[model samples]
Target: MEEQEIYLLITRYLQKETTTEENEILADWITDSVDNEQTFEEIKLTWQHTEQIKLEESTIALARLKNRINHQQDNKAKTKKLVPFKWNAVAASVAIIGLFLVGLFYLLKPNDSVPTTYSVLKTRAGEIKTITLIDGTKVSVGPKSVLRYPSVFNNSERNVSLDGEAYFEVSKNPHKPFKVNTGDLTVNVLGTHFNVNASRNQILTTVSLLEGKVEVNLNSDKDDAYVLKPGQELTFNRANQRVFQRNLDSLNTLGWMTRTLNLSNDKLSDAAVKIENMYGVKLIFADQPTADTRIYAQFNGDSIEDVLTIICASGNLEYKKQGNKIYLNAK
Candidate 1:
């Protein structure tokens, strides 16, 4: 690559705008030689110093400076001794020019710090993991879930991305709100206890608020947002792009936390959905009537067989387990 292009690539890397392939290219260039590593460090410092300036201005300036240096080095390549000499003058020139521009450009503007390091919290099948974030917020990740969060939150807001199920008890901070990104949906909260289920296999992405308030934004649009209160649950249908809000027993949503299958006036179908997710088993209903049966029960860490027995006994239903599938029929 040309010297000008390499400087541009380094700028893109500093701004976190490089693709995976671009990152690989940068990594290779950095490890190619000691001079290349030193050049990278100098450019990094120059980039940091010129953070307040428009990116285009810094990029153009760096590209011009690099091209000049490269031309000077090529001209001196005929002299063996001169070629071995360090280019301290060139490095000093770049730094001085970068500092001058930093003073000239947006001096009073506050710098927005970007998160450079992130940690991913994942759980295997039948596994649950709990973690406290740097902000003192607690998160319980459910089975087969992935939660990607910054090691340290920025000054603006606390943000995390979730791929599956998780329960969040966010720490209260009036200035910085907590945001969870699930596909096209974003959940914003100041401080709240909420359970989010966005499993890939499930047709519905559900958010149940146990305490405090949260705003659910579809496609990151504020106008298409819904504010949910405690005891309210918001369900978004992925197929039709439709959303629904209903009041529900929010405590039932935290059953995974306590290892209990707690249902309060939940339909058989609803219970079946939870059971299927918890046990990694498929629940099939013989008829619609049997699936519509409502039940109110709590099983404290009971076995699947015992829970199924109690559930079937509560209504005129019989259940049979075949492999990983459980079939329910009206008795």
Candidate 2:
């Protein structure tokens, strides 16, 4: 392609005018020589500026056209476009370039003009997940739990919201306090590891600290804070917005966060309810009083049968299953 034709191609590109073949020819010539590249840039930039000027001119033309149409309608005998508009229409070819640059910069800018970003990670019954947060905190969410945070954190603060249970290996950035919003309670830490259990209508949203100090607020909106030391657990009462710190075995409390399950001789009915809710399944008692039967066990990625088989053998309980549902009856 001649260098002269390349100049003509410049106008066409600004108006989005070139066919594929023409554009390829233009691209080839521009990339072929250093002089051609500079010449192409100058031409393109000129076209952009000229295109903006033409756009403004066209907008004015359009406004004038509309006014003339209205005038003709108001005076029926007055003809619209009595003098045909002598628009060369090449103004847009001159004006749109600068606008394109401004728009490009706006899209590529830092923070990208988006104020806040939020994410929710939830697991249902029998399902679990491992997730990483914006602040570089790594989490392992238990079945029937959810963890949420922004896709990106701002320089001012780092925040997350959660429902259910999760083990957090929080990333350390002293200036930005990592905060977790779990319904009525808020867990804050400078840089630490912890586990939290918060769910809807639950009496207590328990928080177990593994490392570092975590400020647990029963009423997140209130000034009151309960600072939990390593190896201490705080049960934030969702009902009354009270925090209770207890001396507990960190291993047992943090058990569910791992691949194991630990239940300290909890009631059979309570355990059943927990299992059903965690897995989103139904546990029907074939015998009404049987559900209240007492049981004790630890689960570590055990199959439903492994847990049931032991429970049945130990408690003299009989069980039956049909489809995804299970029934328990007294033996």
Q: What is the C-alpha RMSD of each candidate to the true structure, in Å?
A: 14.5, 17.4
**What TM-score, over all chains together, does every model reach?**
0.56, 0.63
CA lDDT, candidate 2, residue 226: 82
Candidate 1 residue 81 Cα shift, in angstroms, is 51
Candidate 2, superposed: residue stretches over 4 Å from native: 1-104, 107-112, 240-242, 277-280
User: How many clashes in each structure?
Assistant: 0, 17
Residue-level lDDT of model 1, residues 62-167, one tens digit each, is 5555565677678754542223323344355563444433322233224833335788998865678987665557799998789999855655689999988999
How accurate locally, in lDDT, is each candidate? 0.74, 0.65
How big is the RMSD of model 2? 17.4
The candidate 2 region of ten consecutive residues with least summed lDDT is 99-108
lDDT score, candidate 2, position 228: 86
73-153 in candidate 2: lDDT tens per residue? 466463322332223432343433332322222222346443454678888876778875533467888778888777556
